[model samples]
Target chain A: MADTMISEQVLAPIVENRAVAPDHVELIISSAVLSQAEPGQFAHILTPGMLRRPVSFSRIDQENGQVGLMFQIVGDGTRWLAERRHGEVLDILGPLGHGFAAPDPTKPWCLVGGGVGVPPLYAAAARYLHRSRPDVIIGARTADWVLMAQDFKDLGLDVTVATDDGTAGHAGTVMGPLETWLQDHPDGQVFACGPTPMLAAVSAACEGRATAYVALEQRMGCGIGACLACVVKAHGKEHAEYRRVCTEGPVFAAKELIW
Target chain B: MVIDVSVSLPRGLTLKNPVIAASGTFGFGPEYSRYVDIGALGGVSVKGVSPEPWLGNPTPRVWETPLGLLNSIGLQNPGMDVFLQEDLPFLRDQNAVVIVNIIGHTVDEYAQVAARMNHEPGVAALEVNISCPNIKEGGMSFGQDPDQAYAVMKAVRQVTDLPVMVKLSPNVTYPGLIAQAVEAAGADMISAINTLVGLAIDIKHRRPALGGVTGGLSGPAIKPVALRVVYEVAQSVNIPIIGMGGIATATDVLEFLLAGAQAVMVGTVTFQYPKRMNEIIEALPQVLHEYGFASVRDAVGQALPGRAPIRGGGQ
Candidate 1:
């Protein structure tokens, strides 16, 4: 109840809305209040439906007072969001949930992301650029489906891409490069955001050898932690307890997850 | 002119306004405090408290239907000990009227929670929840059976002197029969209706969308059914009725009042707009004036059968 981090609900005007990839739209909204958002935290966007869609902050520009949201058209909600035009206002509740913690300065770090999960890593990479460049690994179904590889590269971070069809830079899942990275930097920390299977793989690879922080996704309602709708199973005393993916995480240390 | 929205329920439980945040959705008062003024709300029916901390169901507990939401949260709470030690103190600090919604797997458990809340400071009333559809045992089972419902209410009534409002379920064949049974068992008031049991399939996975397989349906889609249940229960019981289910606007609140609900609980809509209850409370006076009703109490039972002719400017 006594929230140390303040989150705001605002009707932010859409400054820019365009397709960044196939069926993926990068929506930028003008909200000086939300520009203060941290990486891995999400914005609960009001769609043309009863429920709000929780989208991660793909890009945060504090100087311009804009927060960018990227999402694919998965259903009526995301499809409706993709159809929104520039200048239209979106009801957004945001900068919510605990974001990825800043990595240790002296230690080496790498980022791993998959599909839509790649966006928050881009925000993380943007923050990491302040200290030194961190390695980034992105995975997608094909070369065309790969998202934000160039975004990370433009940030001057060493980037590696993997696709299921062998059409992109290291074919197969992100595990190949992740395994190699873990072998080389045994003490390196990993920050990841992706599908559950890939995260479980990354968690397995980093176990006992390295540390990993993963950003998770789930179907959510009232992204402000009021509704206990979006919960993820985690190790708890006596038994596994359901933790709020919207609050206790969207970002959790990979070691803490049950999966 | 100012409209008197204050509602006086049985056992000295009086609300400054007619809008109470329903259980489960509001999350014990503090969750929405940043977006809403907790003290300004009529009352907050905290999520169902059992004797022990419940972990609830697995993932994918909620699904979005057209104009509605389906949830199978399974009443996850920190139990009576945590409620008194952690949650109730925060609400007390806010000076908010608290309505503890008690749930149990057995009649004894329900009475145990009721007994625990018996003289707890800052608690205005106890909302006995025997209508939740997510649990495997008790909950909706008690509400669906009149005799079982009567037994649960009677047990809680014996332990607590606070105004007890039994939340009714629409999934039953005759909600009024259950209402009358609880009334006879000494329930001071009734809140109709709890969410309707529903299902949504994830076509891609060819499995149920929610982890619970089925969940309680709530939102704008359930409003009409809730209104119907409120209208029916009003005639069956002499105690005041609190109508809730899909109330999103001041007009919706007034509709419940006309159908014999003394006050209304706002649930699913608050998930969409965190500050919605405050907005509805702010808009009620103008809406009441527009309808030629002097106050919230004046509009009660206006639409009930055999009542005097509708006397309102809008009509």
Candidate 2:
């Protein structure tokens, strides 16, 4: 099946570029594609290199036709993205993959994000604005690495920060505080995105208590389903079924993941 | 005056244009139709089909090289049953020729898939995938050995009435031998070369970049190698050839045609720009006009060294 909008690939101009974290830069691209993007959807950004780099959305503004991309300077691709000035056009094939299913409003929602993974959760948190504020837990290496804490607080969500080196809020991984938070709100659902290890721990913690949807990151080829480059194994009823993270989902139920 | 761009193979199959979407790059079908008119291209070679659904390689299946791409997709597909039931119906509606690229681990598996295709309505040809480098069995193994390639091609040729084209791998030392063997085994056409076996290391991680250890290399890096093989096989065989490797533009297509390929297949490039194949198809007429050829068919093997190479004539 065709997994993406064929005409959604756009050449959007960068309207804003600023450092949101020590190693991360936030890009505000003016594109109509933003209006169609849901929480956890990503864009295949063409850099000054061979393949397009997939980056998830950190924020979306429909009225202004702009979407935010927060990327760390991991390799040549992200470094190229960080260097671009305003008005430069970026070839983005996006708003792709099945995004997060909206959480039930009656039940409380808990959002867990680690390091660069914190961005996509912002958009997910925004969905809870008029209903009820969701509790957000963010993990980083240090105070300088922690991102968008104030932004989540601005949205009226309770923000808990965890740093490995203890330069900020809680002096450990976000899992510790997240576990305690889950205990207080037993009926809450959890949505998370972060390092594989962090996500795995969260998935393990939320096992039978609450349903969790985890956004995965993988090296991708065609941001569409045509290429099977971004496949991950499913642990559902079928023992060894492969699912494309770029097409079927970037966000999948934690129970479905084989990892 | 309108130029005749259509290409008719020595086999009964004929394509609307000389540009076909290579297998593995284009999905089952309908994946690219939303972006471009699928009927505009000469043909669409659907992804490699197997007897059963393949899960494919692990994560990190693709990596980007300079102007090339390395992938170990492992021929992930929905299998013959689902393909015949779900995928083929949509391809039947397209205006282009459909070349089903069939893959199997054994000779019997290959023949079974081919026999099943004989009942399918839309398929114009069967591209026997004996040269894929990603999968552990049956692909490159059959392609590298002339005897194995002959056996597989002969088996499928006997089971199906469709034109059988053996897709050869470049990993072997003597591709001409393999091509000759397949031709003798009733292969109506040849597609050379498949991706070259390659590996890329991540020095920091101290491991291979691809999860499958080594992958098949494609893109501009393999273009010259593909052209040389096509030139060599064109002179040594009686059947037509489909040349492909790192083909990106109309000039590349012209080069393949002049090097003795009757038609060309475009892959890897489709990933970087989804609609690029359409651009190349549209530009072919202008390109053929520049070279003083009235039709794309007229340009085939024009650059060969022989004053008069055999047309349908035997070598």
True contacts kept of each: 0.72, 0.63
**Cα-based TM-score, every candidate:** 0.97, 0.96
Cα shift from native, residue B64, model 2 (Å): 1.1
Per-candidate RMSD, Å? 2.8, 2.1
TM-score of 2: 0.96
**In candidate 2, which residue ranges exceed 4 Å CA deviation?**
A1-7, B307-315
Q: Score residue A256 of candidate 1 by CA lDDT.
A: 87
Q: lDDT tens digits, residues B1-315, model 1? A: 978888877777788999999999999887788899988999999999999998888769899999999998999988999999999999999888899999999999999999999999988899999999999989999999999999999999999998899999999999999999999999988999999999999999999999999999999999999999999988887888999999999999999999989999999998889999999999999999999998888999999999642221111
- Candidate 1 iRMS, in Å? 0.9
Q: DockQ, per-model, please?
A: 0.79, 0.70
Measured by lDDT, the strongest candidate is 1
Sorted into a CAPRI-style docking class, model 2 comes out as medium
For model 1 chain A, the run of ten residues with the poorest summed lDDT? A1-10
Give the C-alpha miss distance for residue A40 in model 1, angstroms: 0.6
- For every candidate, the chain B TM-score is 0.97, 0.97
For candidate 1, write residues A1-259 as lDDT tens digits.
Answer: 2146658888999989989889899999999978888899989888768888999999989999998999988999999999899999999888789897788878888999999999999998897678756898999999988999888878767889999999989889999999999999999999999999999999999999889999999989888777788998889877888899999999999888898
List, residue by residue over B1-315, the lDDT tens digit for candidate 2: 577788877556878788899998889767666565788888999999988888888868998887788999999999999998999888888766899999999998999899999958898899999999998988889999999999999999899988888899999888889999999999989998899999999887899999999999999989999999999888888888999999999999999989999889999888778788889988989998988889877888888896554363122
